[model samples]
Target chain A: MNLYDIATKLDASILTPKLDLSRQVHCAYGADLLSDVLAFTRPSTLLLTGLINIQVVRTAEMAELGGIVVVRGKPVHRSLQELACACKIPLLRTRMTMFESCGRLYQSGIKPCIKDPGCECNVCPSV
Target chain B: MSAPLCKKEFFVQEFDFEHAGKAASDMRKLLMDYGFDQQIVRRLAIAAYEAEMNMVIHGFGGTLIMEINFEYIELVAKDNGPGISDLKLAMQEGFSTASDEIREIGFGAGMGLPNIKRCVNFLGIETKPGQGTVVTMRVDLGPDAI
Candidate 1:
């Protein structure tokens, strides 16, 4: 699914719609730990995280992920929004908790990182 | 290695989460602008970002230097923060000295150094208690690099 679809499905708020949301999200990753996200995430995977910070944007860019969905109804700071705007990484906000968002996306047909085909345990569920 | 095509430096201030990843992002832009291998460039960017954040979250403040050439890219991150007390312990995954504030900012899970080591080809560490620490990392441009 594309970012728009995910947003609609989750009823998320688009914090930085100016950033590109054209790219398709093949997989989904949900984690609060930036370290785990950076370590395990693959390019084009949509990050569903509760942790919102500038590093989240930096991590998305470095990991080559599609975008970030900040869960838990947390208010995204302007700095975070600005960074996403500058970097052109799409940012979404959702009232749904982390687990709920991940489950919704996973059931929507998004998979885990396709880089490792052998493991289909849905660990992070990337495409 | 041949003279670096370009060398750039960035200052990272302790507890400066606001501008933490600027230098690393700059390095990414530089590498991409040079048309280096995409995967290699991503790895370098990750290393750079992790190193840059480490200095900001753990140290008082520091500088990041990027030296780039066709053969490789080297990143040096030096900080005036408390040096690692145990190199071996610090290198282990999930080991962290980050304060609660840092963690609240979405870092300090004890993965910064280890993550950098994972992404780079070479890693070095120099430190003294209460003095400072320096981390040197290198990522080789593969044979396919133009």
Candidate 2:
């Protein structure tokens, strides 16, 4: 689904609406670890994270993620909002917990970002 | 072996979470402005970012130098912090030395170096305990880059 659809389905409040909401996102990854998000996420995938630091936005920018949905009703700081806006990454906030948000998004047809079974990267044992 | 097409440097301060990824983001923008391949630019950006974050989280600040040549782009991150005593241990996926404060902000899960290695064409580390560390990452500008 597109970002706007996800926002509407989750009843999220858009923190950065200047970005194009019609951008399509094929997958989603929920993680609080910035490194894990960097390691596992695919390009243009949406990120559902609990962290509201500027690094979250920076990580999304570096990984080229579609957007960010800050879960758990956390207050997004002004710096985070400014960076998200400058990067043109859509930022959303929801009162729902990470699990609930993930479940709802999954029910709405958003696929999870997963490693390929045939992948050969041996660094992470979880892979 | 001629002069590079472009060269730039950025200073990263220790524990500077506020502006940690600026260098890497600037590098990505520079590559995009240079019209490099999007995939290659993305990979380089990830590598640079991981390196930048490492300096912020672990090291005592550093400088990031980028040299964009016709055939390749290289990023060298040097930090003057407590160097890694065990390079092998530090390279592991789930091993981290970051403090509780660092983890509170969603970092220190020990995926930085591996993520950098996963993104770049070549990765090199040089460190001296109690002195500093330097991470060199390179990505070629060709179809074989991955």
Specify the highest-lDDT model's number.
Answer: 2
DockQ of each: 0.52, 0.65
Question: A88 in model 1: Cα distance from truth in Å?
Answer: 0.7
Worst 10 residues of 1 chain B by lDDT: B13-22
- Residue B132, model 1, lDDT: 90
Candidate 2 residue pairs in clash (backbone atoms < 3 Å) = none
How far off is each candidate at the interface, as Cα RMSD in Å?
3.8, 2.5
lDDT of 1 by residue, B30-120 (tens): 8898888877877888888888888887778899999987677889999998888999999999898888887887788988888888788
lDDT of 2 at A123: 27
Deviation of model 1 at A41, angstroms: 0.6
Which residue runs does candidate 1 get wrong by more than 4 Å? A118-127
TM-score of predicted structure 2, chain A: 0.90
**TM-score of predicted chain B, candidate 2:** 0.94
Residue lDDT tens for model 2, A40-116: 88788899999988889999998889999999889998888989999999999999999999999999899888765
TM-score of every candidate relative to the true structure: 0.92, 0.93
Global lDDT of each candidate: 0.84, 0.88
